[model samples]
Target: MSIWISWMVAAGVVVILELFTGTFYLLMIAIGLVAGGLVALMGSGHELPYIVAGIVGVAATLALHRSKYGWKKNSDASQDPNVNMDIGQSITVKEWQDNGNGKFSARAMYRGALWDVELVAPAAAAGVFTIVEVQGSRLMVRA
Candidate 1:
């Protein structure tokens, strides 16, 4: 088989693998392989196609890595509503207990279980509170 045919076959295999992986990096390399195939079809010297493929693949991967999709915004799982389903849920704090560290806390019944609750600030003894953060089994609340 011709060198161009080999290049095209490699590109097709990479594209097939990219489908299962569901990431664009493999697709970029496949594009570079296609470039190599095109160069081979133009009757370039044997080494030039390999060099062009390597350069194009690396450049495409680097460009993708520098794009916005490459990075995700770091978020605290306890406070981010998307991470925790109970972050914005309201609960009733019938009383606040002084932990003696100048902080007030209470145990509140939530989601059919009693959860340890900590107040964000010193508030009145009894009122409805919104869950702001969840640290383990403890729910941090703000009035």
Candidate 2:
């Protein structure tokens, strides 16, 4: 019925939505709605509450934008498989095979599975290759 009650309800709804979104934007706006409610409680005009709410919301959102948690994560981290724990493990190349891509490949037993190993350069007979990077189940290595 009262303006303060309406602002409080809006803030409560935003807070509920923030739980599912996992973002700080909604929570910042909720802070603004709470500010509006407080202004309304102080017997201010209808316009003043709205203005206060807008200003508070903008300020809060900007604060969040500048914070570390607000920005998007680096996509490179997800694309590079070398970030994994088993990246630097070594594998033995019993023999080298032609990959048809102008690079040589081989089958190596790694992590309990026969993995496709990509050798950047020619490997020696019965050479051991240290895993430099992983691409899916395959490994990129140097002799």
Candidate 3:
């Protein structure tokens, strides 16, 4: 069989496999195979150099995927119009710290709940301010 025909067949099979596995990674490989097939059809050479093509395809896929959806900060706390919005927001401590790790229990109304919180850091005293860093069914506080 000619190099072009082989490449074409390989590309078709890659595409079919990509369909079976919905991962974008396989689809990227298929794209690379298609590129190699096209190169073969152009009579670049009989040996498609699949390794190089695969690398290029994978790289292209990752680059495109990363660009399309990357890290994003959660600004919903500020933008969300809800009652419990103040749960993760910063708050003032009404009580004092009694330990080295700022371990103290204090009462603060947040997200419409009267929470029993112990500060994670002891250095943060009763008068100083802190943030509502975590909230479960209960709340965890930090300085």
Candidate 4:
């Protein structure tokens, strides 16, 4: 088989694999292979060596991935309401409990189940407490 036909077949296979991986890296390599095939077709004596094409494909893929989806150290805080929805929900304290480690108690009717609660202030009375923050399933409260 001709070099051009072989390169084209290889490029087509890489592109098909790219569809499964979805990482864009494989697609880049496929593009490089297509370019090599084109060079072979054009009879450009300056054919891209397979190793050089592979390296170029990888570098291009990485650069594109970084520029398009890289993490930013200074990204703006998320504005989604789901993250801040628990700020002011009223919760009922289930027991009269206290400790020297600030204030703590168990609460019922919170986010579905009884929860161990802690607060920055003492809630001596067992009743409803406002949820100020949530740490996992535990609620931080204030009376």
Top lDDT: which candidate number? 1
Candidate 4: misplaced stretches above 4 Å? 46-52, 68-108, 118-143
Residues 44-96, candidate 1, lDDT per residue (tens digit)?
Answer: 99999999999898898888878886556798998999989999999998988
Model 1 stretches astray by more than 4 angstroms: 20-22, 71-76, 80-82, 121-126
Selected candidate, larger TM-score, 2 vs 4: 2
Give the residue spans of candidate 2 off by over 4 A. 77-106, 118-132, 141-143
Best by TM-score: 1
What lDDT does each candidate get?
Answer: 0.91, 0.84, 0.64, 0.70
lDDT per residue as tens, model 3, 22-93: 666666777787777777777775555566577779787777578734333465442333535545566666
Question: Each model's TM-score, in the order given?
Answer: 0.74, 0.65, 0.50, 0.51
Tens-digit lDDT string for candidate 2 (1-143)? 99899999999999999999999999999999999999999999999989999999999999999898678676553235556765667788898877676678888888788988888666645678777777787788887
lDDT (Cα, tens digit) per residue for candidate 4, span 16-49 = 8878886677778887787777777766564464
Q: How far is candidate 4 from the true structure (C-alpha RMSD, Å)?
A: 6.5
Clashing pairs in 3: 95-126, 101-121, 101-122, 102-121, 102-122
Model 3 poorest ten-residue lDDT run: 77-86
Please give the lDDT score for candidate 4: 0.70
- What TM-score does candidate 3 reach? 0.50
Clashes of each: 0, 0, 5, 0
Assess candidate 1 and give its lDDT.
0.91
